[model samples]
Target: MGNMDISLKEMMAIDGAVGAAVVDYNSGMALGVVGGSKDLDLQVAAAGNTEVVRAKMRTMESLGIKDGIEDILITLTNQYHLIRPVSGRGGKGLFLYLALDRNRANLALARHNLRGTEEKLEI
Candidate 1:
């Protein structure tokens, strides 16, 4: 299994990746972060996205949907934000977040890579 640093490094290697982070949705804290410019503060994004995850979970509960979320995607004019909640035994309450440049990224491939990374991540 891979550690956070290795996972983040793998994520950054994805085409058009601008930023990546492993965050704990329960506390809105990032356990590890890599590649963020002034335009994209990964720490702030992590905190904000915690709410997104929480709201979705609550909504699903309220609606009585028993299925778990595999990933959440937010599209922007210039970027694609992908949030994947880690499903491994040691990864509960944690997520992998990746930001990609829209023009350069292959959404399907990026999603596939992110899922693979999540599966291999140790924490």
Candidate 2:
């Protein structure tokens, strides 16, 4: 079982990682954050992304889709934002948000690493 600090550190070690946060989507709160640059406020970004997760969940519900979300990817010209909802053990209403530099990141490997981190994570 990984604690928040350790988990955040591990996430930051990922290739091209610029920032990472563990947020409570239910409350739009960031429980833990790490590695944000001076230009980016990870806490604020985490809160804003909470809305994105909520909106997608609501849309999925309305569409009557029973499948779970694997991850939400937002690609920009120079970066990638990865949002992964946590749903194991006691996890619910929480997610891991990771920001990566597009030039240095391997999308597939990052996703795989994030999944591994999520599985070992413990609130």
Candidate 3:
């Protein structure tokens, strides 16, 4: 378990991590961000991903799927984007966004690590 800053740093330590952020899906804002390059804007990405999360939630509702989302994965030619909702009490509407280099990252391990980090993250 760790504070927000620590958690963000820990995420950046993951293999092939390019950037990471804690986002508010409701507001499409990033509460905290780390490890983004000039070409990769974490804040903008976070806001855009908020829409993705909302759309998925809406689809799930329409389908009557009660299962909670573990994470949403978007694979690109050069990168991978992961969106994981926070499950802790008082953590709803928040999610962790992680971007990684596809060529260098192990997707399974990165997901595992991010989930573990999400469990430990403190608002």
Error of 2 at 27 (Å): 0.7
Task: Quote the lDDT for 55 in model 2.
Answer: 99
lDDT, candidate 3, 1-123, per-residue tens: 349899899899999999999999999999999988998999899999999999999999999999999999999999999999999986789999999999999999999999999998777
lDDT of 2 at 95: 97
Clashing pairs in 1: none
Off by over 4 Å in 2: none
What's model 1's lDDT at 104?
98
Compose the digit string of candidate 1's lDDT tens values, residues 15-38. 999999999999999999999999
Error of 3 at 97 (Å): 0.2
Cα-based lDDT for every prediction:
0.96, 0.93, 0.95
What value does the lDDT take at residue 85 in candidate 3?
97
Give me the candidate number with maximum lDDT.
Answer: 1
TM-score of each model, paired residue for residue: 0.97, 0.96, 0.96
User: What's the TM for model 2?
Assistant: 0.96
